[model samples]
Target: MLRLIMLATAGLLLGGCLQEEPAFPNVDLHGRLVVDQEVTGARQAQGIQGEYYKRVLSVNGQDMAFNDFVRHYCPDSNTRNETCIKAFRIKKIDDVSGATRFLPNGL
Candidate 1:
């Protein structure tokens, strides 16, 4: 009799666990479409290496297109690369002169 009671209790516990209920709510009855712009080019770079990166920048919760900010700051297209680097908060020049910064072959 005691063994039968134990078996019955275990069966009840296992059965309860096996039953599945919806844990999360499905509020969206209508199908929703999500859209996002694809990211291209280098995400981060410093100085001249960052030239022609063509990447969007985000700063202090504000998003600015790469070329837009670069043109606004530098104005001169020739210095766009340098301006873009500075705008994105990437260090343009190494504080210590004569010291090599980036590795060879864009490593």
Candidate 2:
């Protein structure tokens, strides 16, 4: 029957869709910055100095090198004029030992 064939096709399509893996893994490594930012100047700079953006409410991915994590998430801008993104939690992957460490901010 046409109806039976359509149902089978629909079932196969749904099954295939369901079997697809997520593009980004759902994970919160619960990590924070290891070092604190140094504040020396204006209100804008001071605003960024406080031990904020160190909370591990959410994280992006699973495996990442420490240096890579720093380069990606660490705030290096001194101007502080432009609207910048607050750092997110990063689970740094150790290069030497291949160890996973979650550095929680002791704010």
Top of the candidates by lDDT: 2
Question: Per-residue alpha-carbon lDDT of model 1 for 1-107, expressed as tens digits?
Answer: 99999999999999888734223222211112221122212322322232222234453345654344445554543443433334333223222221122423321
Q: Give the per-residue lDDT of model 2 (tens digit) for 1-107.
A: 99999999999999888633223333333343342223223424757343322223233655553444445444454423121112222322233222234434531
- Give all TM-scores, in the order shown: 0.24, 0.28
Clashes of each: 0, 1
lDDT of 2: 0.39
Error of 2 at 99 (Å): 22
Q: After aligning candidate 1 to the native by TM-score, how far in Å is the CA of 106 from where it should be?
A: 7.8
Residue 44 of model 2, lDDT score: 40
lDDT value, residue 33 of candidate 1: 20
Collision pairs in model 1: none
